[model samples]
Target: MSMVRYKAIIAYDGTLFHGFQRQPQGRTVQEELERTLSKMASQPIVVHGSGRTDAHVHALGQVIHFDYPKERPLEKMRFAMDTQTPEDIAVKQVEIVDELFHARYLVQEKVYEFHVQIGKPRSPFRRHYASYYPYPLDLAKIERALPDLLGTHDFSAFCASGSSVEDKVRTIYEATMVHDEALSELVFTFRGDGFLYKMIRILVGTLLKIGNGRLEETSLPKIIASKDRNCAGPTAHPEGLYLKEVKY
Candidate 1:
């Protein structure tokens, strides 16, 4: 039989796993997934993830690719992996793709959401997924700041200090902040071509400072010009961030 290549869409609550990549000691999404696939194929299998997500960061549409010598129906492949994977990690779908298809290189866009709860107390159910801020925020100020973040620009100021990527420019296709009164949560959603290490977290941190009146809306341009990591606020918690989707 010819070698069969398969692509799968996976979703998982990342709180339990170390991250997407396999680690020597800790449990990881890739390790668990490959172990299951290896069993089904009766051979060693390696899975390639679209990108690496930090620990505690959830994903709804993470993509992965793997290969095996034996050809199996897609449903059987999905069932085999799902039955073996941990409850927190699930295989949403599977499909056969061309041999040249790569999970990381073919990605066209990615969307991420950051959740923040502002109130007197934190909800038990949301403690693991959302960041809590006790103080009230100025929505108007945050809205004004969003415009400055639109369009392509040098985001070295918003990225983590030690990131080695030479190109710091990224386009923000869309960015919006929404308040859900019933859930008492503030959600920040961003869609971009790609992102630098900790870029979303830094953006949220800076916006929170502006909302709390610690930074003025007019200062955003100066912060961008400074191109200094210190100019931005603290990196938001990883738990609050979720990879909502990856567009091909």
Candidate 2:
């Protein structure tokens, strides 16, 4: 029988897994999915993700594609995959697609969100979900600074050093920050054609610095222009980052 191409949207609480990609030693989201899929297919199966999420980083709409050796009902396959996956991961939707569809290569855009709790005592419940910041933030300054990040640029400054991809140019379609007054939390939304490794986390860290006056609001242009990783701020905690959506 010929293999069938299957595309799936999934969400996972990544706190326990090492990351999205499979590592020889640590647990990973891909490993769990592949294990379940291989068992169901009665053969080894490989699952390819849209992209990788760092350890402890969550996903609400991550996408993946895999090929199964046999034909099966899409709904049943989705249900089986969902139920068989560990508690942290969920198969949201599944569909058959053309053989040429490639999740990573065909991706057109991605949305990411980074959350921070501010000026409040830490909540035991949210310790692993939201990053905490005790400093006073100037929302106006941060808002004003966000526009500087829009449009195309070489974002090597914001990228972590471990990334191997040589082409660092990416376009930002939208960038916004809003405060959730009820939770005393700051929510950052970034829509871009692509993001470098740990790009959003590093951007959030720099934005926090600018918000708190450690870095001037006007510093974004200079920092981005530098294209030097050391010119950027630290990478934020993985706990506070989420892969909100992937657009193909």
**Steric clashes per prediction:** 0, 0
TM-score (C-alpha) between model 2 and the true structure:
0.98
The sequence of per-residue lDDT tens digits that candidate 2 reaches over residues 1-248 is 78999999999998899999999889999999999999999999999999999999999999999999977888999999999999999999999998999889999999999989887688777788888988888999999999999999999999998899999999999999989988878999999999999999999999998989989999999999999988888889999898999998
**Candidate 1 global TM-score:** 0.95
Worst lDDT 10-window in candidate 2: 119-128
State which candidate has the highest lDDT: 2
Cα-based TM-score, every candidate: 0.95, 0.98
Best by TM-score: 2
In the range 124-233, model 1's lDDT, one tens digit per residue, is 98988888888768999999998888888889989987788999999999999999898899999999998899999999999999999999977788898898889988
Model 2 pairs in collision: none
**Would you list the C-alpha lDDT of every candidate in the order shown?**
0.88, 0.93
